[model samples]
Target: MTASTTRRTAATKSRIVAVGAIAVAGTMLLTGCGDQTNDGEAKETKAAAAPLADKLPQAIRDKGVIKVGSDIAYAPMEFMDANNQPAGVDIDLGKELGKVLGVEFKFENATFDQLVLGMNSGRHDIVMSSMTDTKERQQGASKDATGGADFVNYFKAGSAILTQKGNPKGIKNLDDLCGLTVAAQRGTANEDLLKTQQKKCGAKKIKEFISDQDSDSITQLQTKRADAVITDFPVALYNELEGGGGKLFEVVGDQIDAAPYGIAVSKKNPELRDAIKAAVQKIIDGGTYGEVLKKWKAESGAIETATVNAGK
Candidate 1:
């Protein structure tokens, strides 16, 4: 359910533009009182009058954009559509956040494992991939020394088992993964889960073929390089419904370890983090949040209210 702390193989290959906060914290921010009806200036006026605009730190308000880091490959959460534009539940929800904050929530695609690292390095303002908000990530529980992030909890999801079509090898659940070769994205919660399950496998410890992206993991499953793929519930379901009309894969059992998906904001930018927390609540209260979930057929993961740092 979490993106791997993906490290880009080459720093220069990153698509992100360095978006450090607008260097000045003294910029005057507007809050719900600007207007311009002239055809030439209408757009500018509306943005200036945005209700939550002032909640952001003046540095970000002046910049007018929140850079987001995302893997852009998990369907129903984030993925490249047929049009090659970013499209999915997270993209739609990010648009909603942009409207309320009166700023652009710009998504910068990178490998799943490197997203949080990017955010910490000032390459992005936040991360909105379907990242599970576990305490470890919130604490940067790794060798990376950038401290970590605080999560604005939004949606909920769980882990699931995905196998090739026809339930080959009779794989039925996590227990069935024993003595089998499985594919998973490196540095993800799924990979950690696999390691946990491997201990139970004893002498038959499951072999793993880890990849930089889940799509590559799926390729492993497809080519018989791996027996199963561990992934989020929505991802498992999405591929079942749309992977050639369910011919490519199947979900074997019920989901496990349900957890919240969070928007990762650097601890250094608490104002932006709290602003986003409020904005997400606004969407849930107004009901647009539910509509986006339904649009992606992910209504099951919807929550009644937004919370902060609730991940276990």
Candidate 2:
């Protein structure tokens, strides 16, 4: 071969070798991009997973106190007992519930409306109030502000009217108190029921009290500002017995509509909800539930069944 041909041949071979090296480098670059892309995605996943506890089951055992929210206005269910300390069927149950769960019990008192807001804001954990579980309230109670769990029905309830010994006007039910003033706690089922009756039957005699505490209604009755006081059966019975066991006032008419009193939890806190439900079941199974009702003089209409099942 000629020298020029040899030189050209050598140059061509070197070019081929250089091109092959470029190809290998390009392949490695592509492979490296793929791996780096996957790595970036994995980092993002880790970042997103940082709040896993927010979605995972809540650690109920860690929360030393089962922070409960209550109005403390509804007597016999939850209120200031004879010793000026919190006592009632619900209070007793809550105490037992905490004891069973190996947690301390803490209560924060607020008005009915404030209780709902407090639960939503995480100011309190569960509400031990004798609150009726309704569709609208259930919707509100299932919200994040309410802690992400639905209500667990623990007791059955219905409304009733409390009046002076004679029931002078013979006010038998909501129908009879059309024009006469009726007292009820603000932002409660009693007031809601009254509003519903007024809207449906054109009755507008409702006097809203600041709280469901017995003193509020007793004061209203003593002053004759209200003709009758509408509240729950347990509360009505409690008030009547407080002054002297039906001697000062009388329970008038039958209960108006059936309702279930439920303990509310956050929608995200199913673990805590289940814990509470389990504690409640323990109380019911141990016969402590009935004893509490009897001690509070609320055994007649207290709940005998539980409907709180976890993961449902």
RMSD of each: 15.0, 16.2
The lDDT per prediction is: 0.83, 0.70
lDDT of 1 by residue, 1-312 (tens): 112223334554331322112212213222222322253255446567676777888887766788999999888799898999999999999999888888888889987778889888888889998988888888998432146789999999999999988988898778899989988887778888898998898888888888888888877887878889999999989888888777988989898899999999999888999999999998898888999999999998999889999998
lDDT of predicted model 1: 0.83
Task: Please give the lDDT score for candidate 2.
Answer: 0.70
Q: TM-scores, in order shown?
A: 0.84, 0.73
Instruction: Look at candidate 1 and give me any clashing residue pairs.
Output: 4-113, 5-113, 6-113, 6-114
Runs with alpha carbons beyond 4 Å of true place in candidate 1: 1-44, 143-146
State the lDDT of candidate 2 residue by residue for 109-131, as single tens digits. Answer: 87766676687688888877887
Candidate 2 — which residues are off by over 4 angstroms? 1-59, 141-149, 203-214, 309-312
